[model samples]
Target: MNRLRFAPIPAGLPATVPFTGPETLERRSGAPFRARLGANENGFGPSPRAIRAMADAAAGVWKYGDPDNHDLRHALATHHGIAPENIMLGEGIDGLLGLLVRLTVSPGDRVVTSDGAYPTFNYHVAGFGGQLVKVPYRDDAEDPDALIRAADEVGARLVYLANPDNPMGSWHPGHRIRAMLDNLPEPGLLVLDEAYAEFAPDDAIPRIDPNDDRAIRFRTFSKAYGMAGARIGYAIGPAELIAGFDRIRNHFGINRIAQAGALAALQDQDWLNHIRAEVAAARARIAEIADENGLTALPSATNFVAIDCRRDGAFARALLDALAVRGIFARMPGVAPMDRCIRVSCGPAEELDAFAGALPAALRAIL
Candidate 1:
C-alpha cells in the first residue's frame, strides 16, 4: 500500500440520509413555514409544571447528570408499577434502538420491520451491517402475522412494530397484536415502539410482562408529553436485557433538566388530559377539512391524520409538494398505497387554519 493512502469508508454504507428536518427545508425554500404540522410535535406544548421544573433545574447545568438515572428510573418504576430493574432510559428511542441493534445484530444478520415504518430503526440496523427484510402494510396497518412469519423465515434478530404507527397513524387492537405475538417464533426479540401510546385508546396498549426476556417496549416523552426537545425515552423489558444497555450506552446521556421536565410532565395528568382532548378535536377538524377538499381521512389513533389523496403516489407527491411550496409543512409514506395518502399532524387551531386555508390552493395547483 502507498504511504499516502488512507483507509476508505465502508462499501455497504447507505448513499442517502433518512430525513431532512423542517428547518433544513425552510432554509432551502428561503421562506419560513406558516404551519409546523409535519413532525407530529404537540403544538399545545408541555405542562406548566414541567416548564417550572426545567427552569429550576437549569441552574444545575454545571454538574453531570446521574449516570444511573436514579431518580428518573425510580419515578418511572413507581409510575408503571414495575421495578426500576425493568427500566432502561436513553437519550431517546432513537439512541436506545442503536444500542439494541448493537446488542443483537451482527454483520449480515437479518432484521424485520414494516416496509414503510419508522426509518430511524432501519438506519441503525443498517449501520450495524444488518440486513433489513420488510413486509408491506395491509390496509395501511402493519400485517403483524406476516411480519412474524417473515422474521422466523429469516431467523431475524429483531422484529420492529410501531403501534399507532407514524406517517399512517394506523393501529390494530392490542389484543389482535398480542394474539400475533403469542404465535411469534421465539429466539428473536419483538421491539414494540409505543411512541404514540398516550394518544391511543386504553385498549390499544398491549398488556405484557415487563419481565419477559423475549421482547422489549419503547416509549417516549417526545410524542404525548410535548417534550420532543428534551430527548427523553425509555425501554421496558426483562432485567437482563434492560441491563444490557448500561454496557453500551452513554451513561449520563439524559440531561438533568430533561429528567426534571419529564418527571413533572408525567405528574401533570390534567395537562395530558387537556392535550388529549385538544388532539381529538384537532383530528376531527382535520377530517372535516379532508372531506371538504374531496378526500377521505383515515381513522387515526395518534396525534395525526392520514388523508387519502384519492389517487396514485405521484399525485400525492405533487399535492405534498404544492403544500410545501405554499409554506405548509407535511409528509407522506415512502411506498405505494400508503404513499397515496398525506400525513398531517394535529396541532393548535392556528396551524390547522393554515392547513385548511392552503388545501384548496394546493389541490388546484397540483390537480
Candidate 2:
C-alpha cells in the first residue's frame, strides 16, 4: 500500500478535539449522564412555533435549502433592523468562523485571542495556518485593552473576543468594547462572538454599526433558540465583508428545516423572554447550590455559572471527574487560575436537582 501525501501545515498540526461531548462520555462510562449540564445548551427547549416549523419543513428534505438563505436572512435583518445584505448564514458560528479565517488569514498570519477563551475559534485559526497570539484573561474577563495591544504588537489580521464569555462566564460592559474597537490597530478585524448575547445584560452588548468594516459579529441559534442540533447561525457585518463569505462558505450547508425553524424562532420573542426569565432563576439556584457546597459562584452574564472551588485547577478537575462518576456531567476551564471553577449550564429544575444531589457526594469523594 502506498501512503498519501499530506499538506505540510496539516501534517505538522496535532490531532485534537475541542470538546468531548456528553454522548462520548456516556459511552465511555457505559451509562447515561443523569444531568447534562456540561454543555451550554438551552435545556429548557425551543419555542413551540420553531418545533412546528421544523416538523413542517421535514417533508421537504428531498429539496436542498435556499443557497442564498433568503427568508432567514431577511427575517434576521428585520429582527435586528439591519439590511439583508449585512447578514450571512452558515452551519453555525463555528462554520462561519472558519470561513472568516479562510477569507482573511494567510499562512502564518497572526490572530489574537484570550488564552482561555473559546477553543473552537483557536481550532479554526490553527486549521487555517494562522499564528495564534494569546493574552491571559484579566480578572477572569477578556481584557479588551490587553487584546488590542497584543493585536497591535503582533500585527494581527484578526482579534477574537467573546462577550458573556464561556468557561469563566465573565463579561465587560459595552462601552469598554466600543473603546477597544476604536483603538484597534488598522487592518486588524475584530471577531466579536456574541453566541450567548441573548442571555447577556442589555448593557453588555455594544452598539456597533452593523456596517462597520473593522468588526464582524457572530450570533447563533444554538444558545437562546435551543437550536443547537440545527447547526444554524449567522454573521453580521458590513455588506462587503458579509459578501466575502459567499466565496468560501458551503452554499447549501444550512438545512431547510433549520432555516425554517430559525425564522420561526426569531418571530417568537415571547418564548425567548420566557427562556430568559427561567435561565435567570436557574442561575440563582445554581449560586445557592454552590453556596451550600462551600464554593463561590462567579457572576455570569451567560447561561452557565462558574463555581469557584476555593482550590486549584487540580481540585476543580477532580470535582468535575467525581461529578461525572456520579452520572452528572460538568466542565472546567482548560487552563490554570480560571480552572479553579467548574462551569455548569442552566437547565430545568430536575436536571439541576440531579446536579444538586450529586454535588455533596462528589465533594466528599474529592476532598
lDDT for each residue of candidate 2 in 81-149, tens digit (9 for 90 to 100)? 999999999999999999999999999999999999999999999998999999999899988999999
Q: Give the true-structure RMSD of model 1.
A: 1.8
Candidate 1, residue 315: how far the Cα is off, in Å: 1.4
Report, for all candidates in order, the number of backbone clashes: 0, 0
Q: What is the C-alpha lDDT of each candidate?
A: 0.90, 0.93
RMSD of each: 1.8, 0.9
Model 1 residue 98 lDDT score: 90
Best by TM-score: 2
Model 1 TM-score on a 0 to 1 scale: 0.96
Candidate 2 lDDT trough over 10 residues, lowest sum: 1-10
